[model samples]
Target: MKRTTVIGFLGSTLDASKQDAARWNKWRPTVGLCMQPDLRVDRLVLLHGRQHEGLAKFVTQDIASVSPETAVEPHTINFDDAWDFEEVYTELLDFAERFEFEPETEDYLVHITTGTHVAQICLFLLTEARFIPGKLLQTQPKRGKPDAGGVWTVIDLDLSRYDSIAKRFAEGSRTSTSFLKGGIETRNAAFNAMIDEIEQVATRSSAPLLLMGPTGAGKSLLARRIYELKAEQHRLSGAFVEVNCATLKGDNAMSALFGHRKGAFTGAVAERAGLLRSADKGMLFLDEIGELGLDEQAMILRAVEDKRFLPVGSDKEVESDFQLIAGTNRDLVRAVAGGSFREDLFARLNLWTFNLPGLAERREDIEPNLDFELKRFAAAEDTRVTFNKEARARYLSFATSAEARWDGNFRDLSASITRMATLSPDGRIDRPAVEAEIVRLGNLWAVEPEQGTDALAEVLNADAIARIDPFDRKQLSEVIVACRRNPSLSATGRELFSVSRQQRTSTNDADRLRKYLARFDLTWSDVS
Candidate 1:
């Protein structure tokens, strides 16, 4: 049979007092606990401070006399001040760690009837957090009956039981998810559900989490948010170390991930602690993980499995107990099939893989994200910019249309907004500005046909395209490409004529661009 076990701090004053012969029939909490009929406490672990040594001994003896079947063990966990939250919590946490627990055969109870109110709170917190796997039992004195035993009731801290509390938690989770996404309001039910699950896993587990998505799909942002959330909960203590595996190459890849000893390479410089050591007790975000070589992948698997790795040019091994969140834009399963990436490594990180959809897949989200980007631009540039009502509608309509291929996802949206905000004549983005932005995006992402690989094919009539000479068409295409990529006329001109703009004292780059556009009967809206 599974036996019930009780753990509590000894009450120095309440459980220690001896009653007179006339009032000897009085009931104490510790003594009353043993007297319960239904509750059979097989063993009791009582924690006491040095000042309460005598009281603890008396309480144990009294418990023994009351319930001879129950085994009592006294543990000394001294606290400098019972009222200090940190000191009391630390001591109790240490005690919980040191105490042996047999969960298979023994059920646990934390008696909150004894010790200071602070200690009781700490025990409740720990129990609720599952740091101490037990239920809480508190004894309350019966009204106007001190001689009679108090009633004991089990406290259930499960939030699911309360509807209102559960709703509050849901609301709080939504708020937390919003905060993590940099205040971007997410309306997609599926995406929101994914974020909720991510938050739960981030707080409750330290296992390797994998975020899979296309480039500019916010994988890095989400990884950083997970780190921030863990740090806020005090679950992680070290710095967040991020590395783009694609940027690391050859010997440098190994040296970057695992520290190298001095004289490990040709340079023979000072020893270096790599990204893994830098992420000890924290989080490591390895973006573009599929780009790592097979040998490096093997080393990463070992580090994740054993928390130990041998740095380059060193016989000794170093350890770092870090939580991993790897980001990849590639289909890792295909890479594994092709033998480019290790299957074992894939299996290890596949436990919590999340696929983030590209912008084209979530077009319904573009409207809000557009506003989010504008707000971000305002904050970054320290200038407020708003679009006119008509301009906003026009832009949103074009953005949500099939012609608008958001190939770069959020990054594309961000760059587009930055351009419009920077070029807005006043605080407001007008219709012309919106039109210019649309044309710019079209030009930048436009795919030229094999027959007519020129700027004239996009915005001009066939007659105009036919009239343009090959050399002039090439020049116009170059000008249009530069203008599409740049935010302002001056910026585009500066890029097109870097040396000429520097030497010509009387020349105006913006005027030069305007005259060039005029030659083809084009305006800024035509080529932007």
Candidate 2:
């Protein structure tokens, strides 16, 4: 076993008594600490003032008389006022820094039973921080036994050593992470990990956070959720103010963000309390922050760093202590390099940046988000809507397929669900609704062919092209061009048969295109 060392202050009143054999009956805490039956204190480091040098020597002798094997070392630490927390803490900190600690060779314990309350608190802090590398040794006078040694208990600040407490903390962390995700059981591993980190930063820090992602990637929703979570925790009092930086421009931008005086500019309207001021003691989410002008960016940087800014046409600075959460789909680093964005402002907001992936990137989570959207619609519209087994399966299959571009991300998914839910007969969606939605989504995603290659020239020789009639050749050429432009045969057919497709109730664009290709002795692989 490693030798034990106990460090504590010399109790002026408790330790000091008549220097005689009769004093043995009175329980001196410092002396009683060494005399504990179970605890074997190898060395005692007693801290005292220069004025208590004689008393220190007497206590050392008293401890030595009973425990001859224990070594007592006195350290002369002086505080002008023992009750002054700063002075006492500083002196104790200096002693802790100067002392040599060897955890492998010696077990160190900080004795908190014999010192000013402030001094004890400082010692506990130092020990907890591992500056002294020790556990806390607290000794109390044994009840109904004045002459007997005190009972001692050791408190280790390393929380991981306690299984129950560590498990509780882990559970709380998971709950907080789930709350940050808006209680959505998101299945994307990368997204879940990002949410976990965001949860920690959101709860522990008041610093500005930067959320970067593509449009409709749920950046605004996440920002609102963060505000709500903080509000629920009682960390924020004022309302959550959100603004799209893309909408603010020119003189109006300044007046909108920083508030305007009664006679600020062209409008000369009444005084306005800007989004920042309105968000005082709360959160301000600046969505599409990359759209703000350089001047606005500079002003925002000042407000973020100093929490004070001059409003439009105002000389004095107004304070708005608000936490900032900036959202952007733009590549800010490139913007900074291109001189469109301020680097200093980027640095300020970059402290806690999180990139949320688009819905396409997290296709596995689409099912859960689909369920969440349906529930949301039901709650908002006051009518429950659900998909039949076949309809739900078909929708999910199409949703997770590569053909579903989902370029608009979560917004597209939410809209699709909302449309189907509204169209559902008696709150139950069936196969017809799913098929109609698929066709609608397909039409919505299709785009006109771009000007490029002549597919007929690439596939057929000069003589073969000459044998065909101009009309048939021209139609075949158009079909081939669409095939080359689109990703799949179905997509190509959709583009080629777009005009004629609306006339037929059940049209197969892919089959139509295949027959047209066969007439020209060509396949999709030939031109595309």
Candidate 3:
């Protein structure tokens, strides 16, 4: 029975704009259908609060309306309707402790949402409970209009992979209260050492921080986390402004960051404050700072370095006092070398720098992240959860194992976690789920959209190997997938390698091709 795959549906009492309701609607049936071989025995249970009995019935009936055999039965736990946050949490914890005790095989898949206070309590406690591992899914409810679509965040639970990020976050949980608020799990020694520097900058009287890391390495989150911690100290309630330079391309972009004077331009019918003004004495997070044009960078550099800015069509420099935090995925040093970025601007912004570690580098944070994820999943389901020891060990073993290079960092960790959590049965994760995820990951890396192997082609076209940055297991798998998709050498070269735009420019293409192929130590025949 411990080996059977089981899928469980969990939802909260608070249904926001019914978007959470709709997400769970899509999640359950899709998982059930995706859970190949239904005859394996255990029943699929959809857990919801007694208050949401009607909503629960609706979700299941809706799923059944489309697929009758996969209808999820509503499982209501014992809890009082009128309970305080603590009481609700305690009750949910009690339920979560007994989650895996159901008389069925240990494998389990649990789906949920971030709502009820009880949900937060129960699932937060699930991390401490070592039961069988399973899939953990969470949906954040959005409010406003009913018909508009809401956002959902999903992660498969594999604690072993995220050990580095999880451990740091856990350590941070003692001092910072927003543990539940999303963060990059950068506990790797590289980031552990770097975070201390970042913290110092946050505490410094006027030290500006420039966050340098790969794309989606939680730079923005870390910046916001620093602001949240410091804002409370000053007793100043200011807003946090996030500016993605890569996204800013035109006049609308100009006005969006720096304010425009009234009748400043054709569209300037009225005076409007930009994100900088809105941030006032708050924190301004500039993401992808390297992507900014020299002109925009010059504008921001003046404002941040000197605390003054000139509005559009106006010569008067506005005095703006705000904490400036910058994040970039591009290499600023290289940008400086290429003359794409200003050395003076880089020097000014280099008051404080924090380099965040990618997910693969930090093996320690994975388990804690896994536990945190489970707690999240449990809370969303309004159910308490636990990870079986065997599944937990298997999940963690991958961390210290030889084959892993987490190129995407925390982003990849979240993806792997979501896959593992949703595939577990009876709330207990099994080995099969882990293996299945590896295969899925392998397939993901095997190919690009219209090319064969980026790595393999890079190798054959170029003389040197192109080592993948933030190397880890997941991305390596994807490289393999790319190789599988494109089998021929000429295709690898002409299609993947020959990307240069110059006369007989196979030199550039061949260089890229060689670097990619060298990562896997393969030649043209490897794909063939």
Candidate 4:
């Protein structure tokens, strides 16, 4: 049984990609996001909304162009209707139960989604693993079919808006293809850092840098950004070698990083040049570097340090003079102390490390992020959309006030915005529509956020940390309900934040979550 990937492209977003923007095809974005080429891809699943039968067929036709035999599995939910997490999850699980996973399947399990809420959640719930560990993609659907072809108009989400918050989704957590929207100072600090690092690296050896951050942060995108920001003289011939550490942890890890000699292991009947060697004279990014086992880490250290790693079963060391930039959310410091991570190796790699911040920290940055999200989501929804000031204020108020924890960081925010924009009533995202989104976001963190409480007080009590982890999505949902019930000062951040005694009524659930993800090793994708 060949393992096949399930690429999910939901509703209007997919339709627009086909009829308008190339991303509407979904296949390109789905397949494109996957940095791995050896991974076998079997099915391209299209989860179309129920109302957009025309759009569903439209996607099906385009997918036929990509994969002729693949069928379009279209399902729908009223985007305009207010729905809870369970409602969506249950439907998704029940709906996907019919699709059985074959044992012999290999290569891919890509779930590129847009409209089918049920299918996307179903895939998340029913996947063999607790959480499907792979790249999550969102393509900006074209707003409309351009009168002329090849216009290639694409909108980007500016993630820098959040104060100190953009860091959480950077590097290791690089998932989305955009930046946060926010204040210029903090975002400028980040750009300065990138420029500084690039200058320093180019000056010396121009070795590849390893980025480390949690899941859903924009690691890959950052790598691309680094490439973009690099001086053309330095960037030329210095390609970016991006590889997910999770996917390459085991046998694949060895073969992928180091070229293997023929009969290297049971599966390797033939010789193959691994990614590390192929990446020579260029950059090699070991994404999710924390996921690598001690032995694997040692092998990576050798490759990065000495630029010589042994091919399995061959005493001869293969030379790979590429600079290494590894990213991971796991606490390598802990791994080193536990004897799982080599202290020497960790020190060698820790020459420069940057930690990213989650969205809530810079609640003030939400508006820009919201604006950026709207453009991106609208294009993906194939419907132009905007948020009324009242709607924007209502959304920001609740969102900043809530105890919502987005475990997936910016990725979660991107997904939420995309879903809401596609479903906004009358294609206008007013305060109510945005509030509906906040509710949907609240569903992710089960804690009820007490309104009108001190925001600083809430952080002091660590309410935000309690919002996401250890609690299942359902539990977080329940917690949100609880906060809603209490709506007290403790429910909000207290004076812990500032010495100024006078306080403001704090927001709820979402803020708490943003705090938690930023703390500890929450930035790691696989870190629980």
Candidate 5:
């Protein structure tokens, strides 16, 4: 059985009475705590100031006379001002840190009846944070009897222990998850689970988040949604600032991100507070973060870690406390390996990395997302649009089928919906509209295959092409495109094996290309 240990401040006024034989008749909280028959306190750790030493001794002796089995240990904890929350909290925190907690062998209770309100709040925080492993012990005087030993109640901070509170929390989690998904009622289990985790992380942490996916896979939209969610929760106060790093070039990149002093460069007519500064106390979404220059990447790393960076042509450093959400379609790990991107910056952003899948990967969710797209279109255009049963069936069948490449992911879906909606005569999309849209998409997708087929025909015969695996044919077609664009085998190899070359001590681009051509029963000369 674990022994019960009570820790509390010595109540100078409440525990004080006449030092006479009649003093035993009055009830003191510290004495009353030990006097409880059901809640046996084997140890009492009394916290008090130096001036209250005499009162502490008196209370200790009084508690001992009644409960001789309880061992009383007095600790002198001085507070500059008992009501000063910071001072009191720091003092108590230090005490909690220094104290040896035997949680397994002894049950600890923080007696909230004796301390100042500030101290009580600090104790509650410490207990909730698990700095002090204990429950709160609150005491009240017996009804209409000021001098009587009070009734005690133990309050547990763990919310999961309370069914009602736990249910409310569960409901709140569902609401937050829904909000993150833009209330789409997404059908994909993996996507829904990812959104749930993103919701939790968005609300709980201010750390930088990395959203990586292919183009138009909703990285930018998701980053904005995160900002909006955090704003709704009052976690951020400033405006959401977004910038495409691909658009920022040369000296403009530095001035655009870290701000610039007057006369910083040729375009410096006035001092500019850049996107990072503009996003203070809020979030900064850097779309296409992999496109940023190495110099800018270095500055971003410093700003992210220290929240302080020197502006362009400025000696002084400025601070901006902004959360970062970096979005990229490019493979940053590959970029880092290729020496195009800073490894340290990648390391910092990789801490909370989440890879969002493309539309092709989440085909099951197309139906619900179709409805969401139509709703968005209705709101944006101020005109309602609906697909007839046959049209909806035709569109979904194509959208979710293997024939649809969906190269641009959600953007492609949104655009397809917008086009169909605009073409609908009486706000009703019919089979004709769906068939026309399908033909248009098919023509768009055909452009790539036509190019690939032309390239492959130049190198191999129809029989040779038929022998190649479909997967290898597609990949080889892309390789042939790269080879034709470049002038030589070495240049083409560098473009294709940019990431893999970094792993080797000796990079033989020409030799590697020659071998790959050999696998296809051809020479570089045959293709080039």
Candidate 6:
């Protein structure tokens, strides 16, 4: 059985009775605590000043007579005054530090009933802060019945069990979620729950967190909010550094992420402190992480594991202890299968992966977000703007309807609101403005075949673009565009070869599209 050890102050003032029998039998808290039937106090460390030596001895004798099993040890501690908060606290804290503890084989309790208010507070602080590995035990004497005895209770200082404390934590999480959503009162329970979890992780952990979602799903926004929250709480001291991996390319990517010495590369005129170093003791938000090359991924893995990495052209390794938050729209598991992303790196970051819902998945949030966007616009432009009753209802109706596909998610909504607010006469958005904005959004969302060709060409390498004949380029562009708009290969292929497929006896549209994509080693993951 584990031994119960009690550490407390000498009750010199409380147990100052002149009569021997009265001193022993009186309702002294420390002695009364030992009198409890169920509690077996194996040892007691009574702290006292030199003047209280006699008192300590008397108390020890009293305890020994009642409970002989308890080994009472009186410890001499110097103190000018028990009421001096700092002096008492420092001495007690030092005593706690120097005292040998066998926590694995013994349970410890700090008796708060015998000490002064200051001494009791200090003991409680020490225990609560984990400076002293023990729970608090308070003994209450029976009122008007000295012989009737008192009650003793053990207090575990875990704030999570308390309803008010838990509610406060929940409120903080809601505030953080609001910060991420640009002050929007988000009504979607699923999205709110996800944000709550993210806030918890952000507050408690420094682990690499992976945010997986569709484009414009608030990953970057949430990551920034997490950094801001940490900074606000003084948990982080360094600047928030962010980089979109999709925009990174070749030597520039390396030089940009890991610092480069002077003359590291052709145009390297001066030494540069990269994004990693800039984010030391802070946060690093890597957006569109799927776009990072395998070599960069390997370097990042090493950096994440051990806060050290070699610069672009330097042999010496630099250190950057940073918390990582990575965002990606790609299905990384599929990317791992396609041999594009590193499996080990994915495994490391996947530990804290959170999938954020796209706007279409949480359409209920659109109405509130609409108001949020207008407010944001008003703040930015220094002009108040509100939609008229009819106009507001109409916009919300269209936005929440099945026809309104929020392809760009919150980004599209913000832009739509900004345009309307800018064009609105005075501070009010009329019906005409709302109608025009809806048409504008509809036209923008409509995927034109020619526009898809432009987008595909933009992503393609110069060499790959040059290799394809003009005729094949036109066909490939249209096909790629179709693939992007449609979720499945069958849908895209049928649309692409509608005329040609009909001419054939039987059409294997998906197979045909797959073969065409194979010419460029492009898979569904690469296109969509």
Winner of 1 and 4 under TM-score: 1
- In the range 154-189, model 6's lDDT, one tens digit per residue, is 998877878898899888777876776668788889
Q: How would you encode candidate 3's per-residue C-alpha lDDT over 1-528 as one tens digit per residue?
A: 364333333444333225344544333332333233433324456555677777766555555544555545566765565246666656555655666654354555444443455554455445335342555544443455442224434354555468897888667643453331344353456655566555555655556778887665689878888888778668336788898888888787778788898999998998878888888888889999887878887888888877888888777777778888899976577578768899988998886776765555456777767777677777776655455777678767864443444445666666776667666647766777777766676566443343324433422333333343445334544454444334344434444434353556335544565576566665544433
Q: TM-score for each prediction?
A: 0.68, 0.76, 0.51, 0.48, 0.85, 0.69
Candidate 1 Cα RMSD (Å): 14.5
Tens digits of lDDT, candidate 2, 220-258: 989998898889889999899999999999988998999
Between candidates 1 and 2, the one scoring higher on lDDT is 2
Choose 5 or 6, whichever is better by TM-score: 5
Per-residue lDDT over 1-528 for candidate 1, one digit per residue giving the tens place of the 0 to 100 score: 999899988877667665454323666788778877778889988888888888777777777876888998888888778899999999888878877878888989999998999999999999998888888999866778465356789876787888999999989787777867777777777777888888888878999999987688899999999999889889999999999999999999999999899999997599999999999999999999999999999999999999999999999999999999999977677678767899999999999999887786677888889889888888898999999999999998999876677767789898999999999858899899999999999988775423235445555666887798889888787787666545568877776778877777776888888999899898877776
lDDT scores in order: 0.84, 0.87, 0.60, 0.55, 0.88, 0.85
Candidate 5 per-residue C-alpha lDDT over 1-528 given as tens digits, one digit per residue, 9 for 90 to 100:
999998998888888888998776677788898878788999999999999999998988888888899999999999889999999989999999999999989999999888788988998999999999999998877777455477899999999999999999999989988888888989888888888889989999999999998778899889998999899989999889999999999888999999999998887999999889999999999999999999999999999999999998899999999999999976687578668899999999998999888887788988999999999999999999999999999999999986787766898899999999999869999999999999988888656534577667657777999999999998888888666545578878987889999999999998888888889997776665
C-alpha-based local distance difference test score of model 3 = 0.60
Ranking by lDDT: 5, 2, 6, 1, 3, 4
Candidate 2 backbone clash number: 0
Task: Give the Å shift of residue 382 in candidate 3.
Answer: 3.9
lDDT (0-100) at residue 492 of candidate 5?
A: 82
lDDT of 2: 0.87
Model 2 root mean square deviation, Cα atoms: 9.9
